[model samples]
Target: MDMKKMAGDKAAEYVKDGMVVGLGTGSTAYHMVNAIGERVKNGLKIQAIPTSKATEAQARELGIPLLTIDEVDHVDLDIDGVDEIDPQFNAIKGGGGALYREKVVATLAKEVIWIMDESKLVDHIGAFHLPVEIAQYGSKQAMARMEECGWKPVLRVRDGKTFVTDNGNYIADLHLGAGFDIEDVREKLGTIVGVLEHGLFLNMCKRMIVGTSSEGVRVIENPSK
Candidate 1:
């Protein structure tokens, strides 16, 4: 079986009839979206709250009903993808630049699930540079501030232009090096002006469906969930 598909299908099994779901972004989540689309066609009634414009478009194309954050009381389940996940199940998401919205939807959901291949699981999260969403207005100042904090932030650019997120915010990919204290960085980033949200998702996921082409799929549970 395809690893991404295996992981995604594993997560789709958790979606019940008529559940209000939080749809996520990225490649692994893309597989889940397609799987959910198939379920929708077979008479599954689900309202999806998409975390990014790209995700919203995919879900819309798949005929999944979408709802704004204000439209629903709360999300029943959220299936997202992570950039990196640690032993404690703490994860770093926002690789698709949807950290702000993803975090919002995940928090509102009763159960949050992340789908990924085996490579995403890590001993620690710092290997992949973390994403920090920020306003474009004072991004230079923000980057300078991060540099002062020793994070070595870099602007995420696209086609010679600064990459822009669905929410019209800019992204700063922080290179914090190995053995860095993620919690301290999270706290410090929160205190910085112009910082909207970072990719460091601490204790948010209830379950992770990790897959590999050789091993099929397996589920890992977070104690908090």
Candidate 2:
């Protein structure tokens, strides 16, 4: 089986009937949503909460049941994609501005299972431009502070204008040098006044389904102890 499809298939097994689940964003998550739709057609009876408007549209087209965050006490599972993931299960996400919702859904779920391809797995996560969503006002101040913290911050603009998130925020691409201290940088950036949320997801995932080009799909779960 193709690795990406295999990863999707593996992720689908974690979704059970009658569960309120978080539907993730990005290509891998797109595949997962399709697999879930198939199961739903077969009477999975799951309630899906999409992390982005794009995802919500897709889910609706597939006839997957939808729910709001306040409608459920907690979600049974959350399966999403990451830009890059380190051995510690720390990840950089939200390249598509779905980070805030994704984080909310993941934290609200009993289990978070991040699915990704082998190319996305990394020994370190900072090399890829880290996405930082922030309030519109005081953005320049935030950018300068990030530079002082050793990140080269660039405002992400689209078609000659600032790229706006689904929630109407801006994304600053923070370019950190290779092998930077992932945990320390995450903490320091998180403290900045204008910072809304950074791409770094630390110790938030309970499990991961990693797809490899040759190895098929492999599952890594946090120790039960």
lDDT of each: 0.90, 0.87
lDDT per residue as tens, model 1, 6-103: 89888988999889999999899999999999999999988899998899999999999999998987999999999998888888888788999999
lDDT of 2 by residue, 1-225 (tens): 666667777999999888889999988899999999999988889899999999999999999999987788899989999988888887889888788888889889888888888888889887788899988899889988988987889999888999988888889998885578877888898789999988878878888898887777999887741
The clash numbers for all candidates, in the given order, read 0, 0
- Please identify model 1 stretches exceeding 4 Å from their true place: none
lDDT of 1 at 173: 96
Global local distance difference test of model 1: 0.90
Give the clashing pairs for model 1.
none
**Top TM-score hit:** 1
